[model samples]
Every structure is written in C-alpha cells, then in structure tokens.
Target: MTYCVGLLLDVGLVLLSDTRTNAGLDNIATYRKMYTFEEPGERVIAIMTAGSLSVTQTTLSRLQDAIDIPDGPSIMTVDTMLEVAEMVGAMLSDVSGKIAGRMGEQASAARASMILAGQRRGGEPRLFLIYPEGNFIEATSDTPFLQIGEHKYGKPILDRVVTPETTLEDAKKAVLLSMDSTLRSNLSVGMPLDLCVIPSGEQRISERVRIDAEDETFQAMSVAWSNALRRGFQEIEI
Candidate 1:
C-alpha cells in the first residue's frame, strides 16, 4: 500500500505521495506515484495514484497512448479542468474494465484509485478523487482535500488544519505532517516522497520535489511536528 494526498486551497494546490509499493512482506520496492503533464502556458495536470501497480501502470500507459494518437482527446485538448477530469475518468474506467475482466470481480475491486489535480489556461484550478469505477468527485469549499491509500492514520491533521481558506504554504506543511503521521503508523508506506504544487492560474507546476530519507529540511520538519504534537498532547488535561 501507499499514501497519496492532495490539498486544494484558495491560492493553489499541493499534492504529496509516497514512493513505496509492496507486493508481499519481502517484496517491497519504491516507485513514484506522481505523474505530471504540462504545456507551460497552456495547461498543467498532475495525477497521484495508490493501489495495484498493474492497474495504475496500465491505466496511465493507455492514457499516454491516447495522447500520442493524432487528434486524440488527450488531457491537453480539454477546454476546462472538469473536462480533463472526465477524460481521465473515462480512460481509467476503460482500462480498469479490461483489467478486471481478466482478473475476475473480487480481484479487480482491489485495483486502484487516482487523485487528479491541476489547471488549464483561462480555467480555474480543480481537484478530483477518481474512484475505481472511473467516476470522480471534485473538491469543494466544504472539503478542500482528497486522499487515497493508507489514509486512516493521516486524516486527523487534515481534518483539523485544512480548509478552503488555508494558504498554499500552510497547505504544504499540512500534507507533510499528514504523511508523517502515516509514516509513523504504517510500515507499508515508506520514504522518498514526491510533492507537487501548482499555483492558481499559472498553467504550470510551480513546485515539485522528491524527499528522500536524508533530506534535511523534511527531516527537521518531521521532527518539529512530532515535538509539537507531543507538547499539544501533554497540555491536554486528562
């Protein structure tokens, strides 16, 4: 399993995903879960996935193949972020159908889910949670975030700190702490995280990072957050 989270704030969007993928206890490995597509001033899109590697890899490959075909309705051709999401949902559902037919019902239900986020020229930024069925729902003012994979351990902080009014910088910190929470509680989701940030209206990814185990800044932030949590707990009267 893995953990991937996305924050949709008033100013921009922040996304983070772990690199770990595990087939069995001794078969653990790392692979990036974040994928980005950009045409600079024209559009920018990012996808973060969690679940069966076969399903996600195949789904992404099919989407890429469509994009490469002449006059294809790739994400780049969509007029709005909503349209982009619909195109992705349709492709994901199509690919998932093919894979499910081969694997049978129960196994296919374990496939995967994707978090899609980004913006296009003249359009507002959007965030979506693409379910295994290839249908999706957008993040709204009431719930400005979406998460997949080992999410139970990390959801508390997001519930407390994230909102439509949160700043992009704070959004980044929130996601990091959320990931930290998951890292502390789950063994399957391991290090070297991928993070992406897209500022509203930019039509480009403004920030992207790969945080390895030895990354000093992330280490320090994690340590500080732990300390803060401890202090907060200590202050609570039992």
Candidate 2:
C-alpha cells in the first residue's frame, strides 16, 4: 500500500507520492511509485501509482517501452493530456486484467490505481485518477485535487482549503500537510517522498523535491500541523 496525491492549480500542478510497498509485516520494501515522461520544453507527464505492485509496474514498464519506440502512442507522444490519460488507463486496465487472470481467486485484491498529471505545450495542465478497470475521472474547478491509495486521512484538509484559485505556495503546504496526516495515521504509507511542481505552460518540471524521513523542514511542518490541530481540538467545545 501507498499514498499518492496530485493537485491542479491555476499556476500548474503539484504531485506527491510515498515510496512504500509491503506484502506482509515482515516483507516491507521501498520502490518509487512516481514516474515522469517528458521532452523538455515540449511536454511533461507525471504518474503516481498505488495498489498491486505487479500491476502498476507492468503498466508503467509498458508505457516506457511505448515511449521508447518511434511513433508509439506513449504519454510523451500523445496528442493531448486527455490522450495521455486514456493511454495510461488502457494500459493499466489491460495489465491488471491479464495478471489477475493468472492469479485466479486473488484477482480481486490484485487491483491497482494511479493519478496522472501533466501538461503539453500549447495545452492546459490536467489531472486524472485512474482505476484498475481503465476508467478515469478528471480534476475540475469544483474538485482541484486527486488522490490514490490510503487517501482518507489526507482528504479533509484538501476539501476545506484547496480551490482552483489556490496559490502554488499554499497548495504545496496543503499537500504536504495532507501527506503528513496520512503518514501519522497509516503505517502502510511510509517515507522518502517524491514531490514535483510543474508551472503552467512551462513544459518542464519547475521543482522536484525528495523528502526523506529525517528531513528537518518536513519534520518541523508535521510537528507544527499536529500542534495546531491539537490546539484547535482543545479550544472547541464538544
């Protein structure tokens, strides 16, 4: 299990994903669930995955293979952000279906999900949450964010504060605090996070940050959020 989120803003997009996968209590492992494809100055695509590692890995591997092939309809080669979302959804659905077919009774638990976000030159930025069945929903002004995996704990803050008009700086804080909330509540979502910011129409990543467990700035922010929440709870009458 893992936690991954993406935010769509007037400025661009912000994406974050934790790197933790576990088969059992004794079999935890770390693997990056975020992948990016770009032709700098032309287009950039980012993806965050959750659920069955096999399904997600195979889907991503196939996408990369397509990107490497000349004239293939990969994310980088897609005509629009909508096309990128469709291509990824189709690949994800196909991979999970085939793998689950071979797994027999465990098919139900072999499902996976992804958050696809990015932009192409001359196009507006876009974000999507794709299910194991290849279906996807886009982020809209009414819902400016998308999350996958262990998302419940982090959703409250976003619901209250995020808007299509949210400033990029505030959006960053909202997402990190959202992730912090999840990390505190879910052991399945562990550390070493990957975060990326892509400003609208830049056609390139503006910032890519990695926050490890020991990162002082993030630690400070987490502690601050916890304290603030505690204070608010204590001040409110039940």
Top candidate by lDDT: 2
Q: Against the hidden reference, what TM-scores do the models get?
A: 0.95, 0.97
Model 1, 32-97: lDDT tens per residue?
899999889889899999888888888888778878888978888868888888888887777777
Q: How many steric clashes does model 2 contain?
A: 0
lDDT per residue (tens digit) for residues 27-134 in model 2: 999999999887788999999999999999999999999988998677887789898989999999999989889988989877999999999988999999999999
What's the TM for model 2? 0.97
Off by over 4 Å in 2: none
Note the clash tally of each candidate: 0, 0
